[model samples]
Every structure is written in C-alpha cells, then in structure tokens.
Target: MAVIRVIYKEYIPSENLNSIVDTIWIATNYGKEIESRILPDGYVDIVFDLDKQKHLNSGNEIRISGMMTKFKKVISRKNSETLGIRFKTGQFNAISNIPLSKIKNTTINASDLFFKLNNSFLDELVEKKHHWEKVQIINKFLLAEINWSDLTPNKLEHSVCQSIQLNYRELDLNKIAKNHYISLRQLERRFKATIGVTMKEYHSIIRFNKVKDCIAKNPNLSLLNTAFDNGYFDHAHLSKEIKKMSGVNPSEL
Candidate 1:
C-alpha cells in the first residue's frame, strides 16, 4: 500500500494561547503505534481498528466506534494500526458533532459516518488530485460537520483552544491573556485544571507531534534537520522532549 498522507498542525489560540488544540488528518494508510500520554485536557479520538484486540484495561474483545474523553495514559504496544481522526482537548467536541463528555467510556459504531465522509475523499485522492485540493476538501468537510454548540464557552481557556486550532503556528499565550483582559496566572490556572498539563508541556507535545509526522513521512530525514525545521531550539532539546513523552529517542525510532 502507498504511504498515507498525514497532515498535522499545531495551533495556539490567538486569544488564549495556553489552551490550544492540535488537529491531525490521516488519509488512506493505516497508522503505526502512536504512544500518547494523557494531558490535563482530555481528547476524543475517532478510529477504525482493523485488527481486533481486547480492551487494554477491560479485557473485552469487540469492534466498535468510540470516544475517550478522560484517560490516564494511552500506549499502543502492537497491533494498533488504524485510520485515526483525533481531537486532543475538552475544548473541541466530537468529530460527529457530539459532546465528548456525553459519550465518554462508551463505544459507538462510527463506521457509517466514517465511510460516508471519508470514502469519497479517499477515492478522489486515488484519482491523483493535488495535495492542496485534498486538504481543502477535508477542511470543508470538517467545517460542515463540526457542531460548535457542543462547546460551551465557560472561560477564556475555551477561546484559547479554539484559536489554536484556527491559527496553527502563530500563538502567544501572554498576548492571548492580555487580549482577554486576564492575568497570565489566571490563564495558567485555567489551562492546568481544564487541560491537565501546564502550558509549556502542552506546547512541547504539540510541537513534537508535528516533528513526529515529518519523521514518519521521511524516515531517512536527519533528526537534527527535523528539529531545526520544526521550531525546536536544537537537536538535544528535541531529543529530550521526544524521550520524555515517547520513552524513545528520535534516532531510536
């Protein structure tokens, strides 16, 4: 099978930088073991598992569509390949326009929705459309299906997370707080409580995930070059963050 085209971007809320979400789009090919730990903010992932396995915590074997809103940690050891569309934050609602909290700890069959929306898109990709066009189509589909109502605006943190997804690269948390007329400390507290990780840790993970995508696409690429290109200060700093979260160095991977 051809390598899948995976598009990933890190977003910082223009108004609230501390509370941002990362959006990832995977097309065509199945994914590899994505070792991710739970952050302060929860996420809802939509995946299609081709190989059947029992639940990690609950030893039950079943094929189902599901949403995980709260998790301590997520580690995929083996046989965990799938087509994953994930939203990592309580600020973002389910891809099916549903509230994540409402569906937490439950599994629903999302095959219909998954196939309905993604099938045609993949077919078009097979037809050899430009990469930009593929991205545009995916964005259009996401915009149409995303239910904004599922998100309740309780605090500035929500605004920040939304802004990050809207503006992928250019994010400044302090500026976002000033814009919202709040102190930096206030923003930090909200982010930690709601998102589960400090602002720095969250941003580091976001940046690292972007680098991971690049490495996955071109395994032959140099790690030093990848770090520099993805906004890390240097290769050592990049290695530190990668090992911290992934338990493996970039070179080891």
Candidate 2:
C-alpha cells in the first residue's frame, strides 16, 4: 500500500479559552489530492483555505462550517494548506447571531457571519509566513469578536448539554429533564436550538466517538466485549450503530 503524505497538527487552547474554543488545527498535503471522512461531533468551525490557488465551494478562501449531523467526505486539494478553528458545542452562538439551525449540515462564506472583520482579513492570513503567526492573528481576532458580543450561553440548555457529553453512555433523557426541572419536550427543543441536533443525535455522536477511540486503543479486544463495555446492548447493536454513523461496520472501523 502507498503511504499518504499529510501534515496535520492541533493546538489546544488555554484554560481561559477552553470553554469556548476547542482547538486550532491545520492540515496540508503537497502531493496528489487526498480524501477524508469527517464524522459529526456537534461543533461549529471556521475554515480558511490558505492556498490562494484553491477555494471553498462558495468560491471563498474563508468559510464557516456549521454543526455536522452526519458523516461527510472532504477532499484536500493538491498543494493545499487548510486551517480551522473548532468551537466547543453550543458556543459558536456567542460569536455570531447566526442560528445553528440555519446552517446545519452546510458550509457558508465566513463574511456572512463575521461582519466585523474586513474582506482583507483572508489576505492578511495568507501573508503570514508561519502557521503559529496565523494562529496568533486568528486568536486575537476571535477574542475581540467574543468580547464585543453580549450573548451568553443559555443556562439550563448549557447544563443539559454538559450532562449529555459527560454521561453519554448512560443518558436518561427523562431523568435529565426532571433533574433540570423541565419537560422532555422543552429539553429537546432547547438542545436542538443550541446544538443544532437532537439530544439523542448528539449523544450518539459522543458515544460513537468513544467507541471509535476504544477500538483504536484496543484493537485486539473482541466486538462483544467492546459492545458491553461501552453500554451497547450487544455486538449486533454496536455494529448497527457504527454502521449508521460511520457507514462502516465495527470491524471495518
């Protein structure tokens, strides 16, 4: 098999920015174009195509990708450099008034959301020689946008989101609603508004990620054991879920 030559890196934010920003990441491929699958993780991102020769489908170098609800395939252009800022779940609302529901499973030009930044901003990023320099510029720009925005995370909605993420394996929606003193319907509505996916869908994404990680770390482990350990009913159930989310069976995953 031929090896794929790609340079990918991620920079996690400091404690002060951790709650809002998940990480800044970059990927480059200088050879033939490559393809990769992106699984949903219920987060929003701002992606910049650093190669002036290429652009997003919108014909812009900068774009905002909304919360993903399913798997999608993306291509890395030949001699491409792409950088993105992934926002934490439900936190992109703090930066822009654009509703998460409006952009679900879609990519739009960044200018539509970041009206505060000038059109020359993309060019400024391209002019930076080092990736770290580009990251610093983005960090400063986002901090300014966050400080000027008055919107705050919804209290109860944020709490429920946290609960689902932390206890994805044993999620009990009714119990969560009762503990938060809200009806199940109300909880579902709020979660959909904040996260751009249903509570169950987000839970599936979190659980699927955990399952994928478990398999990666312990490839020798049996499917039955993995299923039971991760709270799935059985091997068949786990296989079904993995297939549904990733378009591949557990063994293939």
Candidate 3:
C-alpha cells in the first residue's frame, strides 16, 4: 500500500480567507490505511472519495464507500479514515466572497462541483503530470459557476484567510501592512471584520499548523528544537498555545 502523503500546508491571509476558503489535501498512490480523530471548530467540509471508505460521526457512524461526495457542518468523532478539508471558522466567507448574513445555511451537492470538472481532470491526476495546471483549471471552473455574491461576509473572510495562509510564516502582519502602506490597526481591523477572528488567533492557527508539519517531517525532533525552529519564544510558550488551541499537550500528540 502507498503511504499517505501530505502535499503541503498553507496559511490563508485575511483578505483571501474572506474571499476563498482554505484547503487541505492528503493524497496516496497505492491506497493506505489512514485514520485520525479531528476536533470540532465550526468549519464545514465537502469530501471526495477516491477508493477507500470515508466515515464520519453524525448520529451513527456514517460510512461512505466507492465514488461519493457529501457535505456536513460539524462532526464529532474520535477516529475515522481521514480524507477531507477542514474549513476553519470564518473560512466559509471565502466559499464565494459573499456576505455571510445573506447566505442561508443550505446543502450543496458535492458531486455537482466535483463532476463539473472534466473527467480528464481526475483521470490525468492519476498519472501525476502537470497537476497544478489541472488544479487551476478546476478552481477557475468552480469560481465561475459558484454563487459567490450571495455570501459576501464569507467571501471577504475567505480572501483574508487565504492570504494569511499563503504568507504568514514568512511575513509578519506589521511588515505586510507597512509594505501595503496601511497602518497595523487598519489591517487588524479589516482582518477581524472579514475573518471573525483576531490577527493573534489567526497567527496561532498558522503556528500550530507549522508545528504539525515539523513533527510529521521529524518525529524524533525535540519540542524545544521544533518550537525555536518555527519562531516561537520557547518550548513553554509553544506548549501553552498548542494546548489552548487543540486541548491536548504537545507531548501527548
């Protein structure tokens, strides 16, 4: 069986998060046994099944095998096959850069979106050539067809979230604001308004995500080394932030 591959991690900027939602991808070549217990955080997901059964906790454990697609708001599960994107809070704002207040909570058929992409889009991916080009094609197609205007708040939030995700680790907001010729306060306010979270909270999420990547890359890495490598002040501070966000000690994970 092929080992699960974590392609990449991104931090969505406040502007993009307001306009576009964040995405997570786990790809496998030969298929592998993958499971994880995800915590609740108010984001929704639309999952696409490849070959394995995708399960979720919604009353009874919902198992989807074969080619399938579905959507859900929240799930409470200790463990299950992990295949999907975890939309963060305020991430829905980017689903189509529309106002959140105007968007009535509704169900969207996942197959409608997935199938719209040419069968070649999926077929070509199986060969792993020019994958990014194909993804751009899919994204453009979806953006053009989705009703983005109806969710203004989410759209704006999505934009900001995507921007943060893209540049957070390398660029600080203060520098970003100075480069953009805006005051730090102005940037913060704009981010908060669009993303429904403070700049600090967003940064914390980015940092935590970075830590996860570091650990995955080097399982034997020391916590202090990992913390310093990722720009944290020290191990204690990193541990505190991780606990606050994930409700688990770093050592335990």
Candidate 4:
C-alpha cells in the first residue's frame, strides 16, 4: 500500500452542458502514487489523460468508464493529470454511443463507440496546462454530441428517478409506480434500460451517498444521529447499508 498526493479539483459544468454533465474535474497525481476508490453513483464518465498516460494503463487513448454497480479501485500513475466529465444520471444514454447495459461495471476504450475521437483535438488537450482551458476543450466536444432536438428527458425516467431521490429513506416502488400511472414492472424495465442498475440498488446507493455527505460535512456527528437523519431505522441499519455500499461500517470512517 502507498499514499498518493493528488490535486483533485471539481468544477461545475457550464449552463449548456450542465443538464448532461454533473461536473468537470482534474486529477493531478504528483507524489506517493495511491489507489483511487471509485464508488457507484449511477452515472458514467469520459476520462482523458492530460499528460502522456503510462503506468496506470497500457496506452494513452481516451477512455470511458460506465456506471459502477460496486466499488472499483484504480492505481494512480505518478506525474499524471486527468481531465474528465462525470455525466448526470440517466443522461449517458443520450450522449454515449455504447449501450448502458453492455458497459455495466467496466471501462472500455472510447474507440469502442461509434464516433472516432479526434486525434488532433486530443493533441490540443495534452498541450494545455490550465484546467479551465481543458474544460472548454471538453465542452466543445460535448456540445457537438448533444442532440438539440431531444432536449427533454424521458417522462417515466424523470419522474421515477426524482421520486427515488426525493424520498431516499422511504423508497416505495409500488407507490411510485402507482403515483406515476405506470406498473412496477414497467418502471423496473425502464430503469434498467435508462440507468444500468435496478431501482432498489440505485435507491440504496442514493441513500448511502446522502449518509456519506452528512458525515463528511459534520465529522463529529454521531453515527446514531447520522442514521436517523438520513432515514435509517437506527445505527445498526445504517451500519449494514454503509457496509454494503462501501465495504466498511460507519464506525470505520
């Protein structure tokens, strides 16, 4: 095991890309190469290495990581920086050429998709030093990928996903389906297609994320308080759920 010092920065996407992209980020690993834990967030990403990529991967090609269903770890490459786009939930299907179902729990070369990544532009991305400049470069590519006519999200996806997030504690698929005038089976089918994970799985991740945020913001906060606050039945319930998502109990953190 080793410690990696990375200057990781995240920026809000511009208004145009905001609907599709959750954040534009830069990760620069300058010392003590460390491994990164990538958790399931029900979203996908496109990662570009700013410096010539080496140790962490076989080639310098741009890569796309699909929605992770569980935790995955990656070793940090020494003296490298990454510029990436974390797509918003349910939006990857619109921008990516690859099917969400095919990519679950794996990463593949962007060339695996229908569109050919421009080599000339990739050269430009490597030459840039400032993160803001890299963001603009990525934004241009994403803007072209957007389907201007299809600006709206799928109705069932929007409603069901919103309901899950809105009530992270009390996720009732039956109630949600009834409320939306769709059957549970229909919503499950749509959820699996629109997003890679099942509705129950996605809800669990969302709830765990909420608990993580709560703890991250208030380190001194008690586990019992954290559990109750995030709609868990009790500390024991929170512990079990956290372990499922992160492979560790809340006390460990």
Candidate 5:
C-alpha cells in the first residue's frame, strides 16, 4: 500500500463574521485512503467536497453536517480536497431559519435546507485552486447570505448557553431554569429547538471538553483527580462518558 498523508488546516474568519462562524477549515488527502473519527463538538458544518466526479447524485458539491451526538467515521478519499465552514453554536440560524432538530445527527444536501446557496455560488467556491482563495470567496458569500438586521437569538436560550459555559463543571438545570423564569421542561424544549441538543447533552459536551483540555495541559494529572476536579462522580464515571463521546478512554485521549 502507498503511504497516505492528509493535510488539515483551519483559518479564522474575518473579524466581522466572528460572531457567527467559528473557523473555515480544509483537508487534502493524498495517496491511500484514510478513515478519520469525528468527535462531537456541538457545532454544525457546511462541507464542500471539491472532487467533481464523486459529488452527490444530485450533482451538488455542498452538504450540511448537523450537530453530532457521538463519534462518526468519515473516509478521506485519496487525492481529494474538501472545505468546511463551521458555524458557532446556536449561530447557524442567522443564515437559515431551519430548525437544527430537523437535521441532528445526519448529513443532508445543502440545497435541501436553503435555496440561497445556489449552484453557481458553490461552483465558484469549488473552482478556487488555492486554500486562501476559497477562504476569501466563502467569507464574502457568507456576508451576503446572512442578514444581520433580522438575526436575533432567543434571549432565554442564549443566556442558558452562556450560563453553561460559565458553569460548565457544575451545571444546575433547575436553578438555571428558575433564574431564567421558565420551567425546566420549557427551557429544555427551547434549547433543543435552538441548539439542536438537550441542555444535559450540551453540558456533557462542555464538561468533556474541559476535562480533555485539563488532561492535555496537565499531562501529569491523574484520571481520578481529573474526574473529581471536573465534577465527575469518579474515575469510572469519567472514563465511561469519555469513551462514549470520543470512542477513547481518558488515557488514550
């Protein structure tokens, strides 16, 4: 078998688009085919498979990848290039009002969701030969596609998401709902509609990311200590959750 190498890089969007877009990324696969595991990060992505011959049956190069609940595997075909636009959590609604719940844990053609991102625009994006060229085109396209005047996130849901970030280690759903003057059920319903995941699921993602960061930064930290410090019941609980979310144990992570 020939050696396989993949080049992956991420570019920050222009300052004006920072609120809605997380980063624009690209990947190029060379030689042999490779399989990559995508871990859930609670964000949505618009992917463009630049390989014309392997484009979807509909002949559209663009596809929408929804929020992932668990790890999923993707094949990077040899000698293929792909570009991805990752949207910030809860910010995807600015471009298209489609409810995230409709596409959660699934991948769908871009045309199925919104008509604004038409074929010509996608073709222009795909035709770019260099990474920087593609980035510039996408930045300009998103600026035209998103309407700032009418973009408004639900205040309650936004606050809840912010609170989750601030209190990631110890998320109290009941208290959060009470503070926001809504019932737990109502808060969860609104969060699912807006964020495409339950509050608890999002919280788990936040906590897992924190633990992963802590372990990465403090390599000497013991799993038992990390778990307690991050509010996990114990080492066993931490390992189970990590394995479930990332398909790896804490040590492997």
Candidate 6:
C-alpha cells in the first residue's frame, strides 16, 4: 500500500485585516511528492515560501498568485512550509495600485508592485516557532504597509461585489443591475476593471467552488443532489461545468 501524503494546513486569525483578508493559512506538505489541484475561489493571494526551487528561478521568496479562472495544479515537494494570505475579492486593489487584470492568470513577484516590508521580514516570518507568531508578523507588516488610499470606493462597486459573493449561484445579473441603478454595460465594465473577471464569470466560480467544497467534505453527497443544491440544471450540466473549470470529472475531483 502507498503511504498517503499529508499536507498540514493551519489557518491563523487576524482581526486587523479581517475586512480585506479572507484567510491567513500556513501549510506544509509531508511525505512523498504530491500533486494537489487548487480550485479557484475568486480570491487573490500573497504567498511566502521558505523553499522556492519550484516557484521561480530568480530566488524570490514572495509572489502573488492572481485571481484564477480555472483549477491550478500544484506539485508540492516534501517538507516545505508555505505561508499565504488569501485576500477578499476586490480588496487587493485597496492595497496595491497594480491593475488586477494584468496579473489575472499568472503568479508574479511581489516586488513588481510597490508593496514593501522590512528587509528582515521574510527571515523573521520563517524563524517563528509557532504559526500564530508568523501570522502576527504578517498582520503587523500589512497593517503598517496598507495603502489606505486604495480602499476608497467611488460608487457601487464594493456593494456589487459583495452582493454577487453572497448570492453567487442564484443572483440575476439583471436584478443586480437594476438594484444598483447602473446599465448592464456599465456593470460589466466595472466588474472587469475591479474584479479582473466579468460578473458572470465570478458567479460561475463561486458556484463551482461551493460544489467543490461540498464534494470534498460530504462523503454521502450524491452527484445529482449536489447539482440540484448548487443550481445546476442536472448532473450532466454539473459534470460539464466541472470539466470546463477543473478539467476533471466530478468523481476525480
């Protein structure tokens, strides 16, 4: 029998960045090499790696993983620690000036943007003995470096993002536009500019992510039931969408 590889993940809480950051997770993969599929959840992240041979040849420990449209396959080496910050949708812009669209599908060096920290920050973060200590360092760094100007919103963009996130699968774009009192075209443009994906795309991701979570957590969940609960037309429809988004069958996932 093959030994199952375990990837340990610990989520650290942060009251300071609660509004902008969704999760601060520290993970380490143990045992043999493993290929883990990362499903998109409509969020961007900043990852700091203690080991970086697979990330880039440039030897940069920090990189930003942008909003993803599809599942990303990541091969993890044994015994490597990774610390990451998952940002809430539309919140990245509140801290950085870079257009979300530019990095939509790629991971880039954090240095490309103007965000900065103490030179010893990464070293201090890695040397921490406990998970919460690292989270504290990160939270303080972000709170000190957060560019307040980016959080300002001019119109309904903030509310719109929240509305879609709250009602992703069942939301009617028409109704949202009406409630926001913006033309459909204007809504599309704003979503593209702020979210890097159109409103429809974001909603689709949310729906798929929900199902992915369900399937992973609920062993007794039937495919047909999962489809019905998530608003898919049927199992066939769910399977097709899953294939398009994750390039794998529902069973494989």
**How many clashes show up in model 4?**
0
Q: Judged by lDDT relative to the true structure, which candidate is superior, 3 or 6? A: 6
Best by lDDT: 5
lDDT of each: 0.51, 0.82, 0.49, 0.79, 0.86, 0.79
lDDT of 4 by residue, 1-253 (tens): 5556788899888788777889998989988666777777777888876667552345545788877767787777788888788988888866754457677788887756635454566678888878788888788887887777876676788678889999998878899989989888988988877877788888988888888888889889888898889989998999988877777777664
**Candidate 1 lDDT score at position 191:** 65
What TM-score, computed on C-alpha atoms, does each candidate reach? 0.45, 0.90, 0.47, 0.87, 0.90, 0.86
lDDT of 3 by residue, 3-57 (tens): 4543433333234332444554433333334443343233444443332232221
List the pairs of residues colliding in candidate 5. none
lDDT measured at residue 75 in model 5 versus the true structure, 0 to 100: 81
Q: Mind giving the per-residue lDDT tens digits that candidate 6 earns over 1-253?
A: 5564665675645676777888888777767678888777788998888554544443457888988888888766776678898887887876786778788778888877734632356668766888878888878777876776556753587788778878866879889999999898998887777777888888888888888888999858889999988889899999999998898999988
* Poorest 10 consecutive residues by lDDT, candidate 3: 62-71
Model 4 stretches astray by more than 4 angstroms: 1-4, 53-57, 118-121, 150-152, 218-222
Question: Over 4 Å off in model 3, which ranges?
Answer: 1-91, 94-145, 148-171
Preferred candidate (lDDT higher): 1 or 4:
4
**Cα lDDT for residue 173, candidate 3:** 71
Cα error, candidate 6, residue 157 (Å): 2.9
- Give the better candidate number (3 or 6) by TM-score: 6
Report the lDDT of model 4 for residue 17.
79
lDDT of 2 by residue, 145-182 (tens): 88544757678878888898788878899999999999
Clashing pairs in 4: none
Ranking by TM-score: 5, 2, 4, 6, 3, 1
- Candidate 6 clashing pairs, residues 3+ apart or interchain: none
